[model samples]
Target: MAELIDVLLFAFLLATAFYVLLSRDLLAVVMVAGIYSLLSAGMFLVMDAADVAFTEAAVGAGVSTLLLLIALTATGRWEKPAGHRVVPLLVVLATGATLVYGTLDLPPIGKPDNPPQVHVAPHYLERSGEEIGIPNVVTSVLASYRGFDTLGEVVVVFTAGLGVFLLIGGPRRRRGGEK
Candidate 1:
Protein backbone atom coordinates (compact mmCIF):
# COMPACT_ATOMS: atom_id res chain seq x y z
CA MET A 1 0.00 0.00 0.00
CA ALA A 2 2.75 2.43 0.92
CA GLU A 3 4.67 1.57 -2.21
CA LEU A 4 1.55 2.12 -4.30
CA ILE A 5 1.01 5.52 -2.71
CA ASP A 6 4.63 6.47 -3.36
CA VAL A 7 4.34 5.45 -6.99
CA LEU A 8 1.11 7.40 -7.43
CA LEU A 9 2.57 10.51 -5.79
CA PHE A 10 5.69 10.37 -7.94
CA ALA A 11 3.59 9.97 -11.10
CA PHE A 12 1.49 12.96 -10.12
CA LEU A 13 4.65 14.96 -9.43
CA LEU A 14 6.11 14.16 -12.85
CA ALA A 15 2.85 15.03 -14.59
CA THR A 16 2.59 18.30 -12.69
CA ALA A 17 6.21 19.17 -13.50
CA PHE A 18 5.66 18.56 -17.21
CA TYR A 19 2.55 20.71 -17.12
CA VAL A 20 4.44 23.50 -15.35
CA LEU A 21 7.21 23.37 -17.92
CA LEU A 22 4.84 23.41 -20.89
CA SER A 23 2.22 25.88 -19.72
CA ARG A 24 2.43 29.42 -21.12
CA ASP A 25 -0.04 31.01 -18.76
CA LEU A 26 1.73 32.21 -15.61
CA LEU A 27 -1.28 31.74 -13.33
CA ALA A 28 -1.73 28.13 -14.37
CA VAL A 29 1.97 27.52 -13.87
CA VAL A 30 1.81 29.00 -10.36
CA MET A 31 -1.16 26.80 -9.46
CA VAL A 32 0.61 23.72 -10.78
CA ALA A 33 3.73 24.65 -8.80
CA GLY A 34 1.63 24.85 -5.66
CA ILE A 35 0.31 21.36 -6.40
CA TYR A 36 3.90 20.18 -6.82
CA SER A 37 4.84 21.64 -3.44
CA LEU A 38 1.86 19.97 -1.76
CA LEU A 39 2.84 16.68 -3.34
CA SER A 40 6.38 17.13 -2.09
CA ALA A 41 5.06 17.79 1.41
CA GLY A 42 3.01 14.60 1.20
CA MET A 43 6.14 12.68 0.20
CA PHE A 44 8.01 14.12 3.16
CA LEU A 45 5.18 13.05 5.47
CA VAL A 46 5.34 9.52 4.09
CA MET A 47 9.07 9.50 4.90
CA ASP A 48 8.24 10.38 8.55
CA ALA A 49 9.62 13.90 8.33
CA ALA A 50 6.71 15.91 9.63
CA ASP A 51 8.83 18.98 10.34
CA VAL A 52 10.16 19.10 6.78
CA ALA A 53 6.68 18.46 5.40
CA PHE A 54 5.23 21.35 7.38
CA THR A 55 7.96 23.67 6.15
CA GLU A 56 7.47 22.57 2.54
CA ALA A 57 3.70 23.06 2.74
CA ALA A 58 3.95 26.44 4.41
CA VAL A 59 6.84 27.94 2.43
CA GLY A 60 6.55 26.13 -0.91
CA ALA A 61 2.75 25.87 -1.18
CA GLY A 62 1.49 28.83 0.83
CA VAL A 63 4.04 31.66 0.90
CA SER A 64 5.65 30.91 -2.44
CA THR A 65 2.31 30.61 -4.24
CA LEU A 66 1.16 33.91 -2.79
CA LEU A 67 4.38 35.63 -3.81
CA LEU A 68 4.28 34.20 -7.32
CA LEU A 69 0.68 35.34 -7.71
CA ILE A 70 1.65 38.85 -6.66
CA ALA A 71 4.54 38.89 -9.11
CA LEU A 72 2.26 37.57 -11.83
CA THR A 73 -0.16 40.39 -11.18
CA ALA A 74 2.64 42.84 -11.84
CA THR A 75 3.94 41.04 -14.95
CA GLY A 76 2.19 39.54 -17.99
CA ARG A 77 0.63 36.04 -17.70
CA TRP A 78 1.96 34.47 -20.90
CA GLU A 79 5.65 33.77 -21.29
CA LYS A 80 7.51 35.70 -23.96
CA PRO A 81 9.43 33.95 -26.69
CA ALA A 82 13.18 33.72 -26.44
CA GLY A 83 15.79 33.79 -29.18
CA HIS A 84 17.46 30.43 -28.49
CA ARG A 85 16.60 27.24 -26.58
CA VAL A 86 19.27 24.77 -27.65
CA VAL A 87 22.02 26.06 -25.35
CA PRO A 88 19.73 26.28 -22.33
CA LEU A 89 18.39 22.78 -23.00
CA LEU A 90 21.90 21.39 -23.24
CA VAL A 91 22.89 23.11 -19.99
CA VAL A 92 19.83 21.72 -18.22
CA LEU A 93 20.53 18.20 -19.46
CA ALA A 94 24.13 18.39 -18.34
CA THR A 95 23.11 19.63 -14.89
CA GLY A 96 20.51 16.89 -14.54
CA ALA A 97 23.02 14.23 -15.52
CA THR A 98 25.49 15.54 -12.98
CA LEU A 99 22.86 15.43 -10.21
CA VAL A 100 21.86 11.86 -11.12
CA TYR A 101 25.47 10.79 -11.09
CA GLY A 102 26.02 12.40 -7.69
CA THR A 103 23.10 10.44 -6.22
CA LEU A 104 24.92 7.18 -7.05
CA ASP A 105 27.20 7.78 -4.06
CA LEU A 106 24.40 7.84 -1.46
CA PRO A 107 24.00 4.86 0.90
CA PRO A 108 20.76 2.92 1.00
CA ILE A 109 18.14 4.42 3.25
CA GLY A 110 17.92 3.19 6.90
CA LYS A 111 21.07 1.08 6.65
CA PRO A 112 22.09 -0.10 10.14
CA ASP A 113 25.76 0.74 9.69
CA ASN A 114 25.25 4.10 7.96
CA PRO A 115 27.90 6.66 8.89
CA PRO A 116 25.45 9.09 10.47
CA GLN A 117 23.76 6.42 12.57
CA VAL A 118 27.04 4.85 13.61
CA HIS A 119 28.76 8.05 14.56
CA VAL A 120 26.35 10.93 15.34
CA ALA A 121 22.86 9.61 15.92
CA PRO A 122 23.62 7.27 18.78
CA HIS A 123 25.48 9.97 20.71
CA TYR A 124 22.60 12.41 20.29
CA LEU A 125 19.99 9.84 21.34
CA GLU A 126 21.99 8.87 24.37
CA ARG A 127 23.12 12.32 25.51
CA SER A 128 20.23 14.58 24.49
CA GLY A 129 18.13 13.96 27.56
CA GLU A 130 21.02 14.38 29.96
CA GLU A 131 22.84 17.35 28.39
CA ILE A 132 19.94 19.25 26.82
CA GLY A 133 17.40 18.25 29.45
CA ILE A 134 14.77 17.99 26.74
CA PRO A 135 12.06 15.40 27.27
CA ASN A 136 11.69 14.82 23.51
CA VAL A 137 14.66 13.41 21.66
CA VAL A 138 13.69 15.02 18.37
CA THR A 139 13.34 18.41 20.00
CA SER A 140 16.72 18.09 21.62
CA VAL A 141 18.41 17.17 18.35
CA LEU A 142 16.74 20.01 16.44
CA ALA A 143 17.06 22.65 19.11
CA SER A 144 20.31 21.87 20.88
CA TYR A 145 22.42 19.49 18.82
CA ARG A 146 21.60 20.94 15.41
CA GLY A 147 20.76 24.42 16.52
CA PHE A 148 23.14 26.16 14.09
CA ASP A 149 21.71 24.35 11.10
CA THR A 150 18.15 25.18 12.18
CA LEU A 151 19.13 28.81 12.69
CA GLY A 152 20.72 28.94 9.24
CA GLU A 153 17.55 27.58 7.66
CA VAL A 154 15.51 30.26 9.44
CA VAL A 155 17.89 32.97 8.25
CA VAL A 156 17.73 31.79 4.67
CA VAL A 157 13.94 31.74 4.72
CA PHE A 158 13.81 35.21 6.22
CA THR A 159 16.21 36.56 3.62
CA ALA A 160 14.21 35.04 0.78
CA GLY A 161 11.00 36.54 2.16
CA LEU A 162 12.61 39.95 2.39
CA GLY A 163 13.87 39.71 -1.18
CA VAL A 164 10.44 38.73 -2.48
CA PHE A 165 8.79 41.57 -0.58
CA LEU A 166 11.22 44.10 -2.00
CA LEU A 167 10.67 42.80 -5.51
CA ILE A 168 6.86 42.86 -5.48
CA GLY A 169 6.32 45.72 -3.07
CA GLY A 170 6.40 49.08 -4.78
CA PRO A 171 7.66 52.23 -3.14
CA ARG A 172 5.24 53.90 -0.72
CA ARG A 173 3.39 56.99 -1.90
CA ARG A 174 4.14 60.31 -0.27
CA ARG A 175 1.30 62.52 0.94
CA GLY A 176 1.03 65.97 -0.71
CA GLY A 177 4.29 65.34 -2.62
CA GLU A 178 6.31 65.65 0.59
CA LYS A 179 9.77 64.14 0.69
Candidate 2:
Protein backbone atom coordinates (compact mmCIF):
# COMPACT_ATOMS: atom_id res chain seq x y z
CA MET A 1 0.00 0.00 0.00
CA ALA A 2 2.82 2.41 0.72
CA GLU A 3 4.52 1.45 -2.51
CA LEU A 4 1.29 2.07 -4.37
CA ILE A 5 0.95 5.51 -2.85
CA ASP A 6 4.54 6.32 -3.74
CA VAL A 7 3.95 5.31 -7.34
CA LEU A 8 0.78 7.38 -7.52
CA LEU A 9 2.50 10.43 -6.11
CA PHE A 10 5.43 10.03 -8.50
CA ALA A 11 3.05 9.72 -11.45
CA PHE A 12 1.17 12.84 -10.41
CA LEU A 13 4.44 14.74 -10.01
CA LEU A 14 5.58 13.68 -13.47
CA ALA A 15 2.29 14.71 -15.04
CA THR A 16 2.38 18.08 -13.34
CA ALA A 17 5.98 18.64 -14.41
CA PHE A 18 5.14 17.93 -18.04
CA TYR A 19 2.10 20.16 -17.83
CA VAL A 20 4.17 22.98 -16.36
CA LEU A 21 6.72 22.63 -19.16
CA LEU A 22 4.12 22.52 -21.93
CA SER A 23 1.58 25.01 -20.65
CA ARG A 24 1.96 28.56 -21.93
CA ASP A 25 -0.13 30.16 -19.21
CA LEU A 26 2.14 31.51 -16.48
CA LEU A 27 -0.66 31.34 -13.92
CA ALA A 28 -1.30 27.67 -14.68
CA VAL A 29 2.39 26.97 -14.43
CA VAL A 30 2.58 28.62 -11.01
CA MET A 31 -0.43 26.60 -9.84
CA VAL A 32 1.10 23.38 -11.09
CA ALA A 33 4.44 24.28 -9.46
CA GLY A 34 2.60 24.72 -6.15
CA ILE A 35 1.00 21.32 -6.70
CA TYR A 36 4.41 19.83 -7.43
CA SER A 37 5.76 21.27 -4.18
CA LEU A 38 2.78 19.83 -2.30
CA LEU A 39 3.36 16.42 -3.85
CA SER A 40 7.03 16.74 -2.92
CA ALA A 41 6.05 17.52 0.67
CA GLY A 42 3.87 14.41 0.70
CA MET A 43 6.72 12.36 -0.68
CA PHE A 44 9.02 13.70 2.03
CA LEU A 45 6.43 12.81 4.66
CA VAL A 46 6.09 9.30 3.28
CA MET A 47 9.87 9.00 3.45
CA ASP A 48 9.60 9.81 7.21
CA ALA A 49 11.25 13.21 7.00
CA ALA A 50 8.57 15.22 8.73
CA ASP A 51 10.78 18.27 9.26
CA VAL A 52 11.73 18.37 5.60
CA ALA A 53 8.10 17.92 4.59
CA PHE A 54 7.04 20.82 6.78
CA THR A 55 9.74 23.06 5.33
CA GLU A 56 8.75 22.08 1.77
CA ALA A 57 5.10 22.82 2.45
CA ALA A 58 5.85 26.17 4.07
CA VAL A 59 8.69 27.45 1.87
CA GLY A 60 8.14 25.61 -1.40
CA ALA A 61 4.35 25.63 -1.60
CA GLY A 62 3.48 28.66 0.46
CA VAL A 63 6.17 31.30 0.02
CA SER A 64 7.22 30.27 -3.49
CA THR A 65 3.66 30.14 -4.81
CA LEU A 66 2.84 33.51 -3.29
CA LEU A 67 5.97 35.03 -4.80
CA LEU A 68 5.28 33.58 -8.26
CA LEU A 69 1.69 34.83 -8.15
CA ILE A 70 2.94 38.26 -7.15
CA ALA A 71 5.44 38.20 -9.98
CA LEU A 72 2.72 37.29 -12.46
CA THR A 73 0.54 40.12 -11.24
CA ALA A 74 3.42 42.54 -11.74
CA THR A 75 4.22 41.16 -15.17
CA GLY A 76 2.01 39.27 -17.67
CA ARG A 77 0.04 36.06 -17.11
CA TRP A 78 0.91 34.51 -20.51
CA GLU A 79 4.36 33.38 -21.54
CA LYS A 80 5.68 34.77 -24.76
CA PRO A 81 6.60 32.26 -27.43
CA ALA A 82 10.28 31.51 -27.82
CA GLY A 83 12.34 30.03 -30.62
CA HIS A 84 13.45 26.44 -29.98
CA ARG A 85 17.08 26.15 -28.93
CA VAL A 86 18.93 22.88 -29.33
CA VAL A 87 21.75 23.49 -26.86
CA PRO A 88 19.52 23.74 -23.76
CA LEU A 89 17.61 20.64 -24.78
CA LEU A 90 20.85 18.71 -25.18
CA VAL A 91 22.14 19.95 -21.84
CA VAL A 92 18.94 18.91 -20.08
CA LEU A 93 18.98 15.47 -21.66
CA ALA A 94 22.63 14.98 -20.78
CA THR A 95 22.09 16.08 -17.17
CA GLY A 96 19.09 13.79 -16.78
CA ALA A 97 21.01 10.85 -18.15
CA THR A 98 23.92 11.57 -15.82
CA LEU A 99 21.61 11.76 -12.79
CA VAL A 100 19.88 8.48 -13.69
CA TYR A 101 23.22 6.79 -14.16
CA GLY A 102 24.44 8.14 -10.83
CA THR A 103 21.36 6.88 -9.01
CA LEU A 104 22.07 3.37 -10.30
CA ASP A 105 25.06 3.19 -7.96
CA LEU A 106 23.21 4.18 -4.78
CA PRO A 107 22.65 1.56 -2.06
CA PRO A 108 19.09 0.43 -1.49
CA ILE A 109 17.19 2.52 1.03
CA GLY A 110 16.98 1.37 4.71
CA LYS A 111 19.78 -1.13 4.28
CA PRO A 112 21.74 -1.58 7.48
CA ASP A 113 24.93 -2.19 5.54
CA ASN A 114 24.73 1.24 3.93
CA PRO A 115 27.78 3.44 4.56
CA PRO A 116 25.98 6.04 6.65
CA GLN A 117 24.15 3.39 8.63
CA VAL A 118 27.30 1.42 9.38
CA HIS A 119 29.53 4.38 10.13
CA VAL A 120 27.69 7.56 11.11
CA ALA A 121 24.62 5.97 12.62
CA PRO A 122 26.51 3.92 15.18
CA HIS A 123 28.61 6.90 16.20
CA TYR A 124 25.60 9.15 16.61
CA LEU A 125 23.59 6.51 18.44
CA GLU A 126 26.40 5.70 20.82
CA ARG A 127 27.77 9.15 21.54
CA SER A 128 24.96 11.60 20.92
CA GLY A 129 23.74 11.42 24.51
CA GLU A 130 27.18 12.10 25.99
CA GLU A 131 28.41 14.51 23.33
CA ILE A 132 25.35 16.68 22.71
CA GLY A 133 23.52 15.78 25.92
CA ILE A 134 20.25 15.73 24.00
CA PRO A 135 17.79 12.96 24.74
CA ASN A 136 16.65 12.87 21.14
CA VAL A 137 19.37 11.73 18.78
CA VAL A 138 17.59 13.38 15.89
CA THR A 139 17.54 16.71 17.67
CA SER A 140 21.21 16.39 18.57
CA VAL A 141 22.09 15.53 14.99
CA LEU A 142 20.25 18.52 13.59
CA ALA A 143 21.09 21.02 16.28
CA SER A 144 24.63 20.07 17.26
CA TYR A 145 26.10 17.80 14.60
CA ARG A 146 24.75 19.67 11.60
CA GLY A 147 23.84 23.00 13.15
CA PHE A 148 26.08 25.00 10.80
CA ASP A 149 24.49 23.38 7.77
CA THR A 150 21.00 24.17 9.05
CA LEU A 151 21.98 27.76 9.80
CA GLY A 152 23.44 28.13 6.30
CA GLU A 153 20.25 26.84 4.75
CA VAL A 154 18.19 29.31 6.77
CA VAL A 155 20.46 32.18 5.74
CA VAL A 156 20.23 31.21 2.07
CA VAL A 157 16.44 31.07 2.15
CA PHE A 158 16.19 34.42 3.90
CA THR A 159 18.56 36.06 1.44
CA ALA A 160 16.75 34.66 -1.56
CA GLY A 161 13.38 35.82 -0.30
CA LEU A 162 14.70 39.28 0.49
CA GLY A 163 16.35 39.52 -2.93
CA VAL A 164 13.18 38.50 -4.74
CA PHE A 165 11.04 40.92 -2.75
CA LEU A 166 13.48 43.74 -3.38
CA LEU A 167 13.58 43.07 -7.10
CA ILE A 168 9.79 43.06 -7.38
CA GLY A 169 8.92 45.77 -4.91
CA GLY A 170 11.84 48.12 -5.45
CA PRO A 171 11.28 51.68 -6.58
CA ARG A 172 10.33 52.04 -10.24
CA ARG A 173 12.16 54.50 -12.44
CA ARG A 174 10.63 57.18 -14.65
CA ARG A 175 9.74 56.61 -18.33
CA GLY A 176 13.11 58.10 -19.26
CA GLY A 177 14.73 55.16 -17.43
CA GLU A 178 16.62 57.42 -15.05
CA LYS A 179 18.02 55.98 -11.85
Candidate 3:
Protein backbone atom coordinates (compact mmCIF):
# COMPACT_ATOMS: atom_id res chain seq x y z
CA MET A 1 0.00 0.00 0.00
CA ALA A 2 2.79 2.38 0.90
CA GLU A 3 4.65 1.46 -2.28
CA LEU A 4 1.51 2.07 -4.31
CA ILE A 5 1.06 5.49 -2.68
CA ASP A 6 4.67 6.38 -3.42
CA VAL A 7 4.28 5.36 -7.05
CA LEU A 8 1.12 7.42 -7.36
CA LEU A 9 2.81 10.44 -5.82
CA PHE A 10 5.76 10.20 -8.23
CA ALA A 11 3.38 9.86 -11.16
CA PHE A 12 1.47 12.96 -10.03
CA LEU A 13 4.70 14.90 -9.65
CA LEU A 14 5.78 13.93 -13.17
CA ALA A 15 2.39 14.90 -14.53
CA THR A 16 2.59 18.29 -12.82
CA ALA A 17 6.04 18.88 -14.30
CA PHE A 18 4.80 18.15 -17.78
CA TYR A 19 1.77 20.32 -17.19
CA VAL A 20 3.97 23.25 -16.21
CA LEU A 21 6.23 22.74 -19.22
CA LEU A 22 3.46 22.40 -21.79
CA SER A 23 1.06 25.05 -20.50
CA ARG A 24 1.40 28.57 -21.88
CA ASP A 25 -0.67 30.16 -19.12
CA LEU A 26 1.81 31.39 -16.55
CA LEU A 27 -0.71 31.57 -13.71
CA ALA A 28 -1.78 27.99 -14.27
CA VAL A 29 1.83 26.95 -14.33
CA VAL A 30 2.53 28.70 -11.03
CA MET A 31 -0.52 27.09 -9.42
CA VAL A 32 0.58 23.67 -10.68
CA ALA A 33 4.07 24.34 -9.38
CA GLY A 34 2.60 25.01 -5.96
CA ILE A 35 0.75 21.71 -6.15
CA TYR A 36 4.00 20.04 -7.08
CA SER A 37 5.63 21.48 -3.97
CA LEU A 38 2.74 20.32 -1.81
CA LEU A 39 3.04 16.86 -3.34
CA SER A 40 6.76 16.96 -2.66
CA ALA A 41 6.02 17.80 0.97
CA GLY A 42 3.79 14.73 1.09
CA MET A 43 6.64 12.66 -0.33
CA PHE A 44 9.02 13.94 2.34
CA LEU A 45 6.46 13.09 4.99
CA VAL A 46 6.30 9.56 3.65
CA MET A 47 10.11 9.37 3.84
CA ASP A 48 9.92 10.17 7.59
CA ALA A 49 11.35 13.65 7.13
CA ALA A 50 8.51 15.47 8.86
CA ASP A 51 10.51 18.63 9.48
CA VAL A 52 11.50 18.89 5.84
CA ALA A 53 7.92 18.21 4.77
CA PHE A 54 6.66 20.98 7.02
CA THR A 55 9.15 23.45 5.61
CA GLU A 56 8.32 22.49 2.03
CA ALA A 57 4.61 22.86 2.70
CA ALA A 58 5.04 26.25 4.34
CA VAL A 59 7.60 27.78 1.99
CA GLY A 60 7.05 25.95 -1.27
CA ALA A 61 3.28 25.69 -1.22
CA GLY A 62 2.16 28.54 1.01
CA VAL A 63 4.58 31.48 0.82
CA SER A 64 5.77 30.85 -2.74
CA THR A 65 2.32 30.43 -4.19
CA LEU A 66 1.07 33.59 -2.54
CA LEU A 67 4.08 35.60 -3.69
CA LEU A 68 3.74 34.27 -7.24
CA LEU A 69 0.07 35.20 -7.38
CA ILE A 70 0.90 38.68 -6.12
CA ALA A 71 3.62 39.00 -8.75
CA LEU A 72 1.22 37.82 -11.39
CA THR A 73 -1.16 40.62 -10.43
CA ALA A 74 1.59 43.02 -11.54
CA THR A 75 2.73 41.11 -14.57
CA GLY A 76 0.03 39.09 -16.49
CA ARG A 77 -1.38 35.56 -16.57
CA TRP A 78 -0.06 34.50 -20.01
CA GLU A 79 3.57 33.72 -20.85
CA LYS A 80 5.31 35.07 -23.92
CA PRO A 81 5.70 32.64 -26.78
CA ALA A 82 9.15 31.28 -27.49
CA GLY A 83 10.61 29.09 -30.21
CA HIS A 84 12.11 25.73 -29.26
CA ARG A 85 15.65 26.02 -27.99
CA VAL A 86 17.73 22.89 -28.44
CA VAL A 87 20.73 23.80 -26.24
CA PRO A 88 18.77 24.35 -23.01
CA LEU A 89 16.81 21.16 -23.62
CA LEU A 90 19.98 19.20 -24.20
CA VAL A 91 21.60 20.77 -21.13
CA VAL A 92 18.64 19.86 -18.94
CA LEU A 93 18.61 16.31 -20.27
CA ALA A 94 22.33 15.92 -19.66
CA THR A 95 22.10 17.29 -16.12
CA GLY A 96 19.13 15.06 -15.30
CA ALA A 97 20.87 12.01 -16.71
CA THR A 98 23.97 12.75 -14.68
CA LEU A 99 21.93 13.13 -11.49
CA VAL A 100 20.09 9.85 -12.09
CA TYR A 101 23.37 8.05 -12.75
CA GLY A 102 24.93 9.51 -9.60
CA THR A 103 22.04 8.29 -7.43
CA LEU A 104 22.83 4.71 -8.46
CA ASP A 105 25.59 4.59 -5.84
CA LEU A 106 23.33 5.52 -2.91
CA PRO A 107 22.59 2.93 -0.20
CA PRO A 108 19.10 1.43 -0.13
CA ILE A 109 16.68 3.44 1.96
CA GLY A 110 15.80 2.30 5.51
CA LYS A 111 18.68 -0.18 5.65
CA PRO A 112 19.84 -0.56 9.25
CA ASP A 113 23.53 -0.63 8.32
CA ASN A 114 23.37 2.46 6.08
CA PRO A 115 26.27 4.81 6.78
CA PRO A 116 24.24 7.57 8.44
CA GLN A 117 22.21 5.05 10.39
CA VAL A 118 25.30 3.18 11.51
CA HIS A 119 27.31 6.21 12.51
CA VAL A 120 25.37 9.42 12.97
CA ALA A 121 21.80 8.63 13.98
CA PRO A 122 22.87 6.32 16.78
CA HIS A 123 25.16 8.96 18.25
CA TYR A 124 22.35 11.51 18.12
CA LEU A 125 19.87 9.13 19.67
CA GLU A 126 22.30 8.16 22.42
CA ARG A 127 23.81 11.52 23.27
CA SER A 128 21.01 13.92 22.39
CA GLY A 129 19.82 14.09 25.97
CA GLU A 130 23.24 14.40 27.52
CA GLU A 131 24.76 16.75 24.97
CA ILE A 132 21.82 18.87 23.84
CA GLY A 133 19.65 18.44 26.89
CA ILE A 134 16.70 17.97 24.53
CA PRO A 135 14.42 15.03 24.95
CA ASN A 136 13.27 15.07 21.35
CA VAL A 137 16.03 13.86 19.05
CA VAL A 138 14.83 15.89 16.02
CA THR A 139 14.61 19.12 18.01
CA SER A 140 18.01 18.51 19.61
CA VAL A 141 19.63 17.75 16.25
CA LEU A 142 18.16 20.79 14.53
CA ALA A 143 18.57 23.27 17.42
CA SER A 144 21.80 22.13 19.07
CA TYR A 145 23.75 19.23 17.59
CA ARG A 146 23.46 20.57 14.05
CA GLY A 147 22.82 24.16 15.10
CA PHE A 148 25.22 25.78 12.65
CA ASP A 149 23.91 23.83 9.70
CA THR A 150 20.32 24.58 10.68
CA LEU A 151 21.15 28.26 11.09
CA GLY A 152 22.71 28.29 7.62
CA GLU A 153 19.60 26.69 6.18
CA VAL A 154 17.45 29.31 7.89
CA VAL A 155 19.63 32.07 6.46
CA VAL A 156 19.38 30.66 2.98
CA VAL A 157 15.59 30.46 3.24
CA PHE A 158 15.43 34.02 4.50
CA THR A 159 17.68 35.27 1.70
CA ALA A 160 15.63 33.50 -0.91
CA GLY A 161 12.43 35.01 0.46
CA LEU A 162 13.97 38.47 0.41
CA GLY A 163 15.17 37.98 -3.14
CA VAL A 164 11.73 36.93 -4.25
CA PHE A 165 10.15 39.93 -2.55
CA LEU A 166 12.60 42.29 -4.25
CA LEU A 167 11.98 40.64 -7.60
CA ILE A 168 8.25 41.31 -7.10
CA GLY A 169 8.85 45.01 -6.43
CA GLY A 170 7.98 44.67 -2.81
CA PRO A 171 5.64 47.20 -1.13
CA ARG A 172 5.23 49.84 -3.76
CA ARG A 173 4.00 52.88 -1.86
CA ARG A 174 3.35 56.54 -2.48
CA ARG A 175 4.50 59.14 0.04
CA GLY A 176 1.15 58.77 1.73
CA GLY A 177 0.28 55.06 1.38
CA GLU A 178 0.61 51.85 -0.61
CA LYS A 179 -0.12 51.93 -4.34
| TM-score, per-candidate, Cα-based | 0.84, 0.84, 0.84
Clashing pairs in 3: none
The segments of candidate 3 whose C-alpha lies over 4 angstroms from its true place after superposition are 157-179
Q: After superposition, how far is residue 178 of candidate 2 from its true place, in Å?
A: 6.4
Q: Which residue pairs of candidate 1 clash? A: none
- Candidate 1 lDDT, 1-179, residue by residue in tens: 98999999999999999999988888999999999999999999999988889989998999989989998999979999778899999999999999999989989987989888899889888888789997778778888889999899889989988997797556765553794
lDDT of each: 0.91, 0.91, 0.91
lDDT of 3 by residue, 59-164 (tens): 9999989989998999999988878889899999999999999999999888999998988899899888888786778988888878999899989989988997
Report residue 135 deviation for candidate 2 (angstroms): 5.2
Model 1 scores worst on lDDT over the 10 consecutive residues at 167-176
Model 3: per-residue Cα lDDT at residue 112: 92
Candidate 2 displacement at residue 82 in angstroms:
1.2
Off by over 4 Å in 2: 129-136, 161-179
